[model samples]
Target: MSDGIPLIPVIPQALREAAHRGTLIPFVGAGASRLAGCPTWAQLADGALMACITANKFNHGQMEQIRHLSPRMKLSIARAIESEHALTIDYEKLINPFDGYQNNAVGHRVYRSLGKLSKTFVTTNYDAWLDTEILDPPLSVSTDSPVQDTVATPRVRRRIANVEDFTPANLNQENCVFHIHGSLVDPAGMVMTTRDYIRRYANDRGSDDPTRENRTLTFLEVLFQHKTVLFVGYGLEDLEILEYVIQKARQQFPSERPQARHFMLQGYFAHEYELMRSLTQYYAQCDIELIPFRRDQRDWGQLTEVLEAFAEAMPARAPLELQVQMEMESYLEP
Candidate 1:
């Protein structure tokens, strides 16, 4: 029952403050989805390896050659796979495992909670869980047939334009789910090899597409303006994100001056804590604080209770209050 990973207590108090303020912007990663039964990135890597074996193009030898490649280095896996085609490799193999919710209980609980609490989300994983759940409630949100689908092939992908179509008007529904890496169901989705990360974030192509560029900039603007970011599922393994957050903090707090407002949310993983420290030190000018949580401490149920308490304590913020009410009704509805 014991996984070798060390457990650390994420700062629960700050998380509480964020929830109440409704300024908490959650950036979920693969780990968050794991609670919902989805495979981890490493698991997906193994599956891709197996898919290569099944294709028979790569005997045990070729598979060995590509085995060392990281999950992001999936292009190496593609080369080993029988189908050298990008879409084929992605769709037939890497896509299925992350397609929909892996289990009903985990999916329903998490999505329901997400529906209730979060207004905006950014997930690194390619799963459609959030997209499917948005329209249908307890069911998968990613599966809801989008009003339009322009993806003609697996190689090409599309971005979910904006929340205008889905968000209710009177509600001032500023909340949205942004799939930074794209989704599994959408072939044009952003999932790609290690080179993709280099091309996208590292190389600054994340802004290449006008829409993507605008959105990324907007996200940064909102973040600087708002000053609260809840990091879920991110292990700090991605240095690019570390760099971005640091830079954003610096821009907000230009001199040796303290930041007007800025905070972060991270799971109670020890590595995450270390990463947080390193980041703060690197961006010493910006007084960014971190809120951490250990989901496994009492399961997500307890986590929700804590977040709810956090939300309750926040000073009155009308916009977030309205969003919370709408989500609560939708979640509690029979």
Candidate 2:
């Protein structure tokens, strides 16, 4: 342990090694934002059903079973409502409710831990939780406030959402957050509905395509091929994105999951022995190592400690990892 911080045993050594080697990246999911008061995908989907009921639009055919529909299917209904009624799904207000949200201490702690872990982050979530919590301004920039984190560090710019933004020429400049599904900035771009997911998949050139031109696909493909990604803030139900990637990778590389160096931080209960075993077997099949933390009731309180330990265990790196190392030993001067 560096200094006196204890490394969580569940955090695999290879993940730490990848961190030191500058290959590990955190793939944030909705569960992380839920810590900060954002709605879960199920809750968000429920909003759609509630909205339909409030609008007196519920209970036609499958709409009769709207309450029972899965989140994805519920979102498909939302899309239909938006199309038919010209009603807007205020995702921003739903995501970042204008309550005492800024004072979300636990959420901020998690986001800050993420900042220390890596400069390049990938998240499927569309909220500005990370943008509000993580900052890396230039050292030259001075803040009037006494807060140290708001100044000179790994500056997190606005999330990169466009296909044009993922290029190494663009990403190599500074800290980057890749929001694979679009953020709240562009509702049209965000993948929420079933149709949206289909459209996104259509745009992606599969892993086998050497000549694929889509920047997002290339970025994901390259990261999976080369990096050890530790996926945090995901639940058993919300791992469709991770599963999608593995399936795609198998089309090209069938011997193992394409993301062979992947890991996920998961929560389970004391009584979920059988469930845990099944999940472990499933994740192993997908080539992901589980970093399980036991939780109680509705609180994943230990997740914060686990994240903190991960940040502390992984050695820090020079800025702009794709460039030369900041602490490099001397090579022979040419």
As a TM-score, model 1 comes out at 0.61
Candidate 1 lDDT over 190-262, as tens digits, reads 5456654544443232445754443343344444444355555555565466566446534533554422354
TM-score, every prediction: 0.61, 0.78
TM-score of 2: 0.78
Poorest 10 consecutive residues by lDDT, candidate 2: 325-334
lDDT comparing candidate 2 with the true structure: 0.68
Each model's lDDT: 0.49, 0.68
Q: Please list the residue runs of candidate 1 whose C-alpha ends up more than 4 Å from where it truly belongs after superposition.
A: 1-18, 75-87, 90-102, 132-172, 202-218, 244-288, 293-334
lDDT of 2 by residue, 11-108 (tens): 68888777776666788998888877888888888776667666776645655666677888888878788778877777777777754245666666
The 10 consecutive residues of candidate 1 with the worst lDDT sum are: 149-158
